[model samples]
Target: MSKATSPVRFKAKLLRPAKPANAAWTFLLVPKAASAKLPSRGQVGVEGTLEGASFSAVLEPDGQGSHWLKVDNKLREAAAVDAGDTVALEVTPSGTMPEPTVPAELRKALAAAPEANAVWADITPAARHDWIAWITSAKREDTRTRRIANACDMLATGKRRVCCFDRSGMYGKGLSAPEAM
Candidate 1:
């Protein structure tokens, strides 16, 4: 359900990653009470503005059980937001995450591995997104191919996700697809 900005809005200083373990620079303050009225962090489908820049994002739970939004580099640039700046944030439940696109190779691999395909169908959209992100994050053609192959192997054997994917976006210390060199 869509919501007006007023009720869901808050002003908080952007914060840096708190420690070595928290590597993502993100918004420091979230209206925790208001967020409870929205979807859970796991299903953070929300459309809102950061300092007036419009974006779609997910709010996920942190170790302390509070919701946090990761403002990626692109969003920070577009909004001119930086760590330590106080900015207005408006978040409303956008529902579920947009489905991640499966690479053609991953699709082909899944087709050849019926077991993986079956498991794929049973997973939540978020779980599927994890696999897709891991596969698509690969910058090199060969790397992407390997991730796809690995995805099939894991899924075929009933693995819900690639082991150690930093799905939390925390320190990003997981099985992330290699970025372009």
Candidate 2:
């Protein structure tokens, strides 16, 4: 097996739900261990098993010296955990894996739009991942360019992936949007 896929093991406690909205589920987390070597934000291919069910999560650093393991909601439901369940976390370090390189033309276009870059940088890695995935998956260049332009416009205006346009056709700012585009 490739070293890139090797898993690291750690013990974690399921944190108690901070609010009632999250009370239905629990989180098994690595919560900033001073001695633990955790992955940084945007690291991919992280895997773990919670309650005997294996799952994958993306590691995102909170910038306060801690990282979050973003597991899918379906997996969370399957685990039947509540806030504060002690569990184990296993993850593979993000290796020298190649990511889809942005086309030169697209890079130039993005570079020309400073506001877009600023907004894009401010977004979460997961959101950026979605945009990259969409653009790279397009079978045609025209579609990709159009989507890129739209994405740039959305970023410049600080609108997220889904909430760029509201029901009234007006854009709202400050945390109502997904910021994942």
Candidate 3:
């Protein structure tokens, strides 16, 4: 049988506490269809504006058929979200492409290259940001090739812009082999 898939959208109210609490809550959003499967951990993404600050979170299932989200500090501080302020949740089947595995040799080369580090440190943060965004955004082979080439050129001069090295270090120590990809 084919797997069932559909976008789920819902409105949720933020519940505040009577006192400042470090704990977060697990509020539920009923799926639009009874047969609609709730997203598993790392299968959900959120985008919204709260108290004039916008943020996004990737929801990860806690394995109990419940979802948990880690909100950025900006959203938490701006909203002053308490036990009862209403928040909205919209979940859709993400069309995200799987990230390609950057070869370990390339990662090690970048890490060990003193020139690369010097160049990377010289670049502005915005340039680094753009480089990272470009590399991670591409899912196609040609795009990946272009990004890698661009990165190589940047790193050859010891200039780290953004994508000069795999900052996440998919090949480095302590990472599970499965998670490396």
The candidate scoring highest on TM-score is 1
- C-alpha RMSD of candidate 1: 7.7
lDDT per residue as tens, model 1, 53-113: 9988756544333456677778888899788788888776665676656778887899999
In Å, residue 23's CA in model 3 sits off its true spot by: 7.4
List clashing residue pairs in candidate 1: 45-94
Q: What is candidate 2's lDDT per residue for 1-181, written digit by digit as tens? A: 1233466666666554454454444444345551145434323436567666677555543334445554445766677664455656666664433233466765777799999888776776556655665454455889878878877887788865534322111122211111111
lDDT-wise, the better of 2 and 3 is 2
Per-residue CA lDDT of model 3 for 1-181, tens digit only, reads 2222554445555433322345343233333341134433223444445444555544433233334444444566676764445655544444432232345534554577666656655665434444544564465767766775667677766655553333223322211111100
How many residue pairs clash in each candidate at the backbone level? 1, 6, 20
State how far residue 51 of model 3 sits from its true place (Å).
7.5
RMSD of each: 7.7, 12.8, 12.8
Tell how far residue 60 is off in model 1, in angstroms.
1.1
Candidate 3's TM-score reads 0.33
- Stretches off by above 4 angstroms in model 2 are 1-5, 19-25, 31-36, 39-44, 71-73, 94-127, 130-151, 154-181
lDDT for 165 (candidate 1): 64
Taking all chains together, each candidate's TM-score versus the true structure is 0.56, 0.44, 0.33
Residue 86, candidate 1: C-alpha displacement in angstroms: 1.4
Error of 2 at 48 (Å): 2.2
The TM-score that candidate 2 achieves is: 0.44
Ranking 1 against 2 by TM-score, winner = 1
- Better-scoring candidate (TM-score), 2 or 3: 2
